[model samples]
Target: MIYVIIGILILAASFIWMEIAERRIQEWEKEK
Candidate 1:
């Protein structure tokens, strides 16, 4: 049960991280 909770948290964090990364990439492209 604990492992399942941890897995979910990790997945959520990674998803959020990816979103932030995508936004940053877009901003960078605009600057170019």
Candidate 2:
């Protein structure tokens, strides 16, 4: 059960990171 919770947290964090990275990339493209 603890492992499952940890896995979910990691997945959530990675998803958020991906979203942030995507936004940054878009901003960079606009700047260029």
Candidate 3:
């Protein structure tokens, strides 16, 4: 049960990171 919860948290973190990275890339492109 602990491992499952940990896995979910990691997945959520990865998705958030992915969204942040995408926004940064979009801003960089606009600057360019």
Candidate 4:
């Protein structure tokens, strides 16, 4: 059970990080 919770947290963190990276890329492209 504990492992399941940890796995979910890791997945959520990675997903959020990906979203932030994508937004930054979009903003950078607009500036160029």
Candidate 5:
């Protein structure tokens, strides 16, 4: 269960960061 929780946490962070990076890229594109 601990391993599962850890995996989920990592997966959530990966997705959240992916979204943040994507939005930042979009904003950068708009600035160009």
Candidate 6:
């Protein structure tokens, strides 16, 4: 059960990181 919880947290963090990276890329494109 503890391992399952850790897995879920990691998934959530990766998703959030991806979203932030996407937004940064969009902003960079707009500047160009």
Candidate 5 wrongly placed segments (more than 4 Å): none
Candidate 6 lands at a TM-score of 0.85
Error of 1 at 23 (Å): 0.1
Model 1 lDDT per residue over 1-32, tens place = 99999999999999999999999999999999
RMSD of each: 0.6, 0.5, 0.4, 0.7, 0.6, 0.6
Q: Report lDDT (Cα) of residue 19, candidate 5.
A: 100
Among these predictions, the greatest TM-score belongs to: 3
For residue 15, model 5's alpha carbon misses the true position, in angstroms, by: 0.5
Off by over 4 Å in 3: none
Sort by TM-score, best first: what order? Answer: 3, 2, 1, 5, 6, 4
Q: Using Cα atoms with residue i matched to residue i, what is each candidate's TM-score against the true structure?
A: 0.87, 0.88, 0.93, 0.82, 0.87, 0.85
Q: Compute the lDDT of residue 15 as modeled in candidate 4.
A: 100
Per-residue lDDT value at 7 in model 2: 100
CA error at residue 19 for candidate 5, angstroms = 0.5
lDDT of 6: 1.00
Clashing pairs in model 1?
A: none
What tens digits encode model 6's per-residue C-alpha lDDT throughout 3-32? 999999999999999999999999999999
Clashes of 6: 0
C-alpha lDDT score of every prediction, in listed order: 1.00, 1.00, 1.00, 1.00, 1.00, 1.00
Model 6 clashing residue pairs (backbone)? none
Off by over 4 Å in 4: none
Clash counts per candidate, in order, are: 0, 0, 0, 0, 0, 0
lDDT of 3 by residue, 1-32 (tens): 99999999999999999999999999999999
